[model samples]
Target: MEKITVTAQRKHRDNLPTGSVFGYLPRVVLAAMLASAAVLALIFSEVVRGWEATISAFAISWVVPGQALSLGQVAYFGLGTANPRGIDITELCSAVIIISPLLLLAALLLLMRRFKIGTVFKALAAGFLIIVLANVIRIVMIAFGWDHFGMAGFDAAHQGYGSAFALLAFAAGMIVFIRLSFGRKHKSQQ
Candidate 1:
């Protein structure tokens, strides 16, 4: 049998498919397409519009002691307060909005040859879970603060603390994904 030289092996590897979408196309073209797709997902998010209410309902149900009742998109709370509180679940309060951008960024990363599709999927999955959990905690904090300390506490948690926490969680999740995707391993040459 003939021995294959390192140059020959390198050439063979170069010819093989990279497994990216439109890998045969120019990298710049592919990158632009992927970026545009990501932007479009945010622009026309019909599927994601109602997800805020659904996810909030599920999260509120999980956080509260009893069943958290949602009439339409509003979550009703306050057991023995002067009046029952209705927390309206809006796009700003939903995890789906935050998760969508991450997913799009992952797709862009895949297109730009930063990592494999499997890595992107894994990262996106983990990020999605984190975002959902963070959003739930935010809502809970707002509701609990409102019930206990009145409007000031609610505003502080909703406008100040909870929003910051959610943004931090999203950033942390994305950072983890990037590290997992691009962290290089060195192979010792014999």
Candidate 2:
């Protein structure tokens, strides 16, 4: 009779799936399912309903002083200005849209079994923070453009240059996730 080494047994267990479903399901299929579920949850959850206002307040405060955030309407107001130019933040402009896809991508990577769950989760967190910060910068840029120049400037920033920058930021985030999750391993010298 052969005895199994404790370390070898532990390694085998580590490679096994956490549940029976995960064990038998194909990785691609699992990734698709997880991605769909995550996106749907984010879309339907009230937990993030306040994100628009929160992001607006942060961006307004950073870009202009004494700017007040209005509730319900989801807009910002300038102090003492008769015709204060404010940006009305909507769900489309919120970071939720951008963050959702990135999260989906991360979840896909996790389910695909290319990387350890811990590593995927950490990278996902960092990527989310990066996306959120980029969104803030985009909002501030729009505000500054509107303040300095008007609708044309705002349009240029919002629809033209800003969109490109957003795409770049998102791509950079994806690249970072890929590098972190699939980084090359170096062989140790014997």
Candidate 3:
């Protein structure tokens, strides 16, 4: 009889509505989504290498004058045909790493708002392009600065302009996400 009573009590305790486990679902999903994105980005990095070659060829032909340009040349002014002062990939990678997380956070916010998946993806893609473009420009500027004032100038640009541009890109991405998400709704409501 005691065993039965204890069993019943245990069952009752077990059956008493367990707190929702789904509370963490959103966070888990967000983490998984971001992880998957990062993995895919890494996988696609190889593909980007090929694309980079093509782009480098094109940039050399159209954008910058003189002989074929190298990544180091374009990244900074010290290497290759760019100038004696090239920027290099380390600075470019640093800029990308710093800016990418902010952009990702902004994207997650838009995603959490229940925006359409397609819209979110489009916004994310646009944001990435903006960052890439801005980074390229930043590298160019750093290279030019290095050419003019040497490493000190390059370092200054990295600290000041690079940070400012990253913030601007992040803000721009968020703004674009918000605008894209709500603009349709606003028009429909009107």
Candidate 4:
């Protein structure tokens, strides 16, 4: 029985999804391309910012503690706050940047892995959801910080823990990407 299992492992080794350091090249390249595209898009496209800012403002309004009024790309928080100024949804805070890594992984996985089409798509959807949700949480954190602690809290959440939160989200998305890509169930025979 053990011999038969060993034989099976040997036969399937070539098809195993995970590999060496170079395997991550797709992830890195995709991330860079997405980041570059984000910069270019922000510079050239008002339409992009229009939708993003609206989305950001609407989302904050839905969840923020105080009443929030959204206009254009800024979300104004009210109720006698220290910094009456609202938060602006900037190019840097684009969800495209947060989700680029996972989407790129999905694109490259098409060549590197023998995943079922359904599985690949599930990963893509899940990846988008994970990163987007994380970004929303980061935004909410900033809003909450600003609402409570004024500019100091805002700075702490945005400059201090905001980055760390985003990094953790990226790490989490990568982990999910690996698991979905390498789902160790019966091969779909694709």
Best candidate according to lDDT: 2
Quality of model 4 by C-alpha lDDT: 0.66
Candidate 1 residue lDDT tens string, 1-190 = 9874576547766876866555645554544665676566567654453455455656655544445555665777653446567678676676657766776677677665546566666766777777777877788888777766789978998999988998898788777777766646666455
What TM-score would you give candidate 4 relative to the actual structure? Answer: 0.65
Q: What is the lDDT of residue 28 in candidate 4?
A: 51
Question: lDDT, candidate 1, residue 6?
Answer: 77
Q: Rank the candidates by TM-score, best first.
A: 2, 1, 4, 3
| TM-score against truth, every candidate | 0.70, 0.72, 0.54, 0.65
lDDT of 3 by residue, 1-190 (tens): 3432345536666764445557445545765676566555555554443443334334434443344445522322223554543334542343345344644554465445345555655666676666666655555555445556767877876777765776687568656655664436432221
Q: List, in order, the clash count of every candidate structure.
A: 0, 0, 9, 0
lDDT of 1: 0.67
Cα deviation at 13, candidate 1, in Å, is 3.0
Better of 2 and 4 by TM-score: 2
Better of 1 and 4 by TM-score: 1
Most TM-score-accurate candidate: 2
Give residue 129's lDDT in candidate 3 (0 to 100).
Answer: 68
Q: Write the per-residue lDDT of candidate 2 for residues 1-190, one digit (tens) a residue.
A: 9864566546876878676784646655646765886687476534453565566666677666566575652556455555476666566766677777876887668665557767776777777777777766777777777766779878998988877777788777777776777756766433
lDDT of 3: 0.52
- Displacement of residue 49 (Cα, Å) in model 2 is 5.7
